[model samples]
Target: MTDHGPQPVERQLPTEESRALISLVRDLTQREIAPTAAEEEDAGHFPREVFGLLSASGLLALPYAEEFGGGDQPYEVYLQVLEELAAARLTVGLGVSVHTLACHALAGYGTKEQRRTHLPAMLGGGLLGAYCLSEPAAGSDAAALRTRATRVGDTWTIEGTKAWTTHGGIADFYTVLARTGGEGPHGITAFLVPGDAPGLTAAPPERKMGMKGSPTAQLHFDGVEVADARRLGDEGQGFAIALSALDSGRLGIAACAVGVAQAALDQALSFTQERRQFGHPVADFQGLRFMLADMATQIEAGRALYLAAARLRDTGRPFAKQAAMAKLFCSDAAMRVTTDAVQLMGGYGYTADFPAERYMREAKALQIVEGTNQIQRMVVARHLAGPGGAP
Candidate 1:
C-alpha cells in the first residue's frame, strides 16, 4: 500500500494568531521537511538550509522575547508548534529544541547588554547553536562535569572535552558549562563561546542508531578562551542555570515524543486499513483495532501531559516536577506506542520500506535524551518527596 503522510492533529491553541502560525508551520513542514525526511535521514545529510529557513521564518525563536528577534510566543503555543514539526521530522524538531535550550542561558540570565549584542543574530540570523554540559564521564550526573575554565586576567581559558553534544561541530555558537573552581556543581560556570573560537574542535560525529541526520559528537575545548563579557549569570552558578534550562528542555522532549507516537499511530492506521488478512482489512480485526486504540490513547495522554506542563511554565508556576513527569511519561509512552505500531504492521513494519521502523528507532532515543527516564524519575521524586526522600 502506498503511504500517505500522517493525519492532521487537532490542537488547542490560545489565539487566532497561534492557529495561523501553526498552519504556516504545517504548510512549511509538508512542503519542505516531510517530503525529504526519510531520504535525507537515510543518507545521513544534515539539512542546514532547512534550519536556515526555519530561522528566517521565525520558527526557531518562538518562545524567546521579541526584543531580541524572537517570535514572543508563549510556551504553550510554541510547544504545539514543536509537536507539529517533530511529527514531520524529528531532526528538525529536536534541533529546534536544542537550539532553544542553548538560548535559554542567555535569554533568561544574561545581562541586558549581552542580550542586545548577541541574542538577535543567535535567534534569527541563520545561526545554529549547541549546548555543552555533559562530558565524557558526566552524562546523567552533569554536576560532576570535568571541563575546566580558568580565569586568566580578563579572559577565561576553557580546557576539556564535552561528550554527546548535539550539532557539535556545525553550530554558530555554543552554551558551554565549565568548572571555574573546585569540584562538583558549585564550581561550574556558563559561557557563550563563539563556534569558531580558537583551539575548539569537534571529533567526528558518533554513529547513531536513529536521527542520523542530526550530528552528535564530542567537542574538544583545547584551551578555548572566552572574554569575561560572555559569561552568563554569576560565577559558580552554571549548574543551576543548566538545570533551569533542562526543566524547560524536558518539556520540548515531551512534545517531540508525543509527536513521534502520533506519527507511528497514523502510520499503523493507514497500513492496517490497506493491508488485508484472510480476505479482510487487517484493521477490521479486533486485535489490531485494540492496538491502534492503545496507541492513539497513549498519544493523546502524552499530548495532554506535555501541554499541561507547558501551560504551567507559561503561567509562571512551579513546573519542574511536572516537566520531569511529562518527559518521563511521554518518552516511555512513545517507545511503547511506536513498538506497538511496528507489531501491528507485522513483517512489513520491521523493514526500512516503511516509516514505522524509523519511528520506533527514533522513539527509543527520546527516552534517553534531555535526561534519561531514570534521571527524570529522580527529578520528580526529589520534587515530590524532598531530596533526601524524607516525605
Candidate 2:
C-alpha cells in the first residue's frame, strides 16, 4: 500500500460510535476544511459556511447534552475530535471550542426553562456563538473587569468594551461578563445577548499575528439592553461560572495546540523524506533525524497531558490544576515544535509558500489564549503549593 504521508491517529475512544465519529471528522477535514485553509487565512476571511456545515452535521455541539440536541460525547472523545479538526485548520477547532465555552454558562447554570428555550437552537440550529469576557483592561485579571450592566426593574443596560473576543462581529449570540454588583469576582455577572442587539457594535477584526481566519475584535456594548431573563446564573455567581467555563476551555485550547504541533511535525517529516540534501534525502542526516525525534516526543507528551486532564473532567473529578498544566505545556510545546519545523526547512519555511511559517504563526496565539502560560503556572502553583506558598 502506498503511504499517503502520516496515517490517521488511532484514537482511544470510549465507544464504536466515537470511533465512527472520528472517522467521519477526518474524512470531512481532508475533503472540505483542509483545502482552503491557507488561502482563506491569507485573506483574513471567516468561513461561516463551514461552521454552519459543522453545526448541521452535529460536530459543533459534541460535548454538550444530547437532550438539548448535543452529541453528549465525553470530553476525551470531543477533544480528540477537536485535535483532528485543528490539524486541518486551527480556526475550525478553536472556534468550536469557544462556541462550547459560550454555551457552558447556560447549560450548566441556567434554569430548566431557559435551557429548554435556547439550548436546542444554540446547539443544533446552525447558530454560531462568541464568548465575551476579556475587556480592554481585563485580559488576564478577568475579575477586574469594569464593564457594567445596570438594571432598571426588568431591563438591563450594558455599557463597556470587550477586547479579544472570538467571532465578535459575526456571532449569532454572545455570552458576556459584566460588573453588576460592587467589586471583585462576586460582583460580576454573565448575560446572553443577541449579536444584533441595538447599540452593540464590533470594531474591525484585529490584525493578529496568527489564526487570521478566526475573527478577533473589540465588542462595544453601548447601552445594549437585555431582559432580566437573559442573565446567566444568579447575582454574584458569574465569576464562578466564568471560571468553570475557562477550566474546560483551557482543555480545548490544549487539544488544538497538540493538533497544530502534530501538523507541523508531519509536514517536516514528509518534507525531509522528499527533499534531497548532500545528494541524499534530508532525512538521512542524523542532526535532522534527532530534531524530528524531539518534535514527535513533544507532540506525544502534550497529547498525553491534555488527555489525562480530559479523563479527569469526564469522570467528575477536579481537574483544574491538570487543565492548567496541560494548557501550559501543550501551547508552549506547540510554539517550540512549530518553530523547529520552520527551521527544518532552512530558507523555504520562512516564506508563506510552505505551511511551516503559517503553522509557526498560528502556534503563537495558543500560548496567549485561554490564559497566558504565566497565568497557567500561577494556577498550577496555587493548586500545588497552596495560596502564595511555594518553597
Candidate 3:
C-alpha cells in the first residue's frame, strides 16, 4: 500500500540542482515517508519527525529567499517538490503547503525588521506553522468574519475562533487575520501570533474522512495579547494579504491534486497489466484501456496547467486568473481520476488492502481546500468578465 514507482511522465527542470533535489525528495519519500504512510494514516498519527527531517534537509524553505535561510528556489521547482511529497502522502504534502501559506504574510508583507528578526528561524528552523482565516460563519464569505482584534495602547488583544486550521493544535506559530475596525474586508488586519500565547488554544483535531494524520481544528484566541510589533501589515490590509497568499496557495493545492491523481493512475495501470481476463491481461481490453488513457491524460493536463501558473508566478506576473483555473481543473481532475482508478480496480479498489480507496478519499479534500471548486469558478468568471458584467 505504501509503494508508488516512478511516474509515467518525465519532468523538465531548470537546473541540475533542481533535478538532484527531486531525486533526493523521491528517495526520502520511499524510505522515510512511503514505508509508514499507510500505517500512520490508519493510526491517525502526525509525523512531526518527518517534517523535522524535511526542515533539516532544506525542503521546508525551498521557495523563500536564501538570505532568510531559504533555498531560494523558484515556484516551479517548489511546487514539483510538493507533487512528489503528495504522491507519497497527502497529509505531508498539504501540511507543507499550509506552512508555506502561514509564512506568506511575514515574508511578503512584514517590515524588513520583522523579516530579519523572524523569517530565518521560520524558513529554516524545525518549527511548524498554521494559517488562521476561516471562522464558523465565514468559510467562503471571508469578509463576514467576526474575529476581533482591539488596540490597547502598545498591545493588541485578539479574540476569535478560527475554524478548519490545518495544524491547529501542534503549530508553533499562527498567521492570523482578525477584524480591527469595521464589518468588512477593508477593516481586517493580519497578526503573527505565537502558538503558546496566553489566551490562544486549539480544539481537538477534527474527525475527518481522510488525511486524518494531519490535525484540523478550531483555534480559540480568547483575548490573546500580542505586542503591536507583531502586526504583519498595515492595520486595514489583512484581507488583501490573505487573498495574495491564497493565490499562491491555490497553486500548491493544484500540484498536490496532480500528485494524487498520478499515483492513482500508476496503481491502476499496474493492476490492469498484472490481472488476467480470460487468456489475456486486463490491459488488453480496449474499454479499460481507454479509461486508463483518459486518467493519464487528465493527470498530465493538470500538471501542465499548474506548472504554467507557477511559471507566471515565478516571473512575477499576474497569475490569479490562471491560478484559479488550474485549481478548478486540477482538483476536479484528481477526484475524477481517483474515482476512475477505483472503478477500474474492481473489488480490490474498494478494499482497504489496496490504496485506490484511500487515494479516492484523499482526492475529495483537494477540491475543497484553499478554495472550493465553486469559488474557483467564481474567481475565474470575475477575471474574464468583471463582477455582474460591469466591464
Q: What tens digits encode model 2's per-residue C-alpha lDDT throughout 252-332?
A: 999999998888888888888888978999999999999999999999999999999999999999999999999999999
**Tens digits of lDDT, candidate 1, 228-337:** 99999999999999999999999999999988888889899999999998999999999889989988988999889989999999999999999999999999999999
Stretches of candidate 3 above 4 Å error? 1-8, 389-391
How many clashes does the backbone of model 1 have? 0
TM-score for each candidate, following the candidate numbering: 0.98, 0.97, 0.98
Q: Point out where model 1 deviates above 4 Å.
A: 389-391
User: Considering every candidate listed, which one attains the maximal lDDT?
Assistant: 1
The per-residue C-alpha lDDT of model 1 at residue 220 equals: 97
Among all windows of ten consecutive residues in candidate 3, which has the lowest summed lDDT? 1-10
Candidate rank order under lDDT = 1, 3, 2
Error of 1 at 48 (Å): 0.4
Off by over 4 Å in 2: 1-7, 389-391
C-alpha RMSD of candidate 1: 1.3
- Residues 1-391, candidate 3: write the lDDT tens digits: 4345436357889999999999899989888987788789999999999999999998889999998889999999999999999988999999999999999999999998999999988888898999999998999888889999999998999998999999998999999999999988999999999999998898999999999899999999998999999999999999999999999999999999998898899989988888897988898999999999999899889999999999999999999999999999999999999999999989999987878888999999999989899999999999887897422
> Can you rank all candidates by TM-score, best first?
1, 3, 2
lDDT of 1 at 348: 95
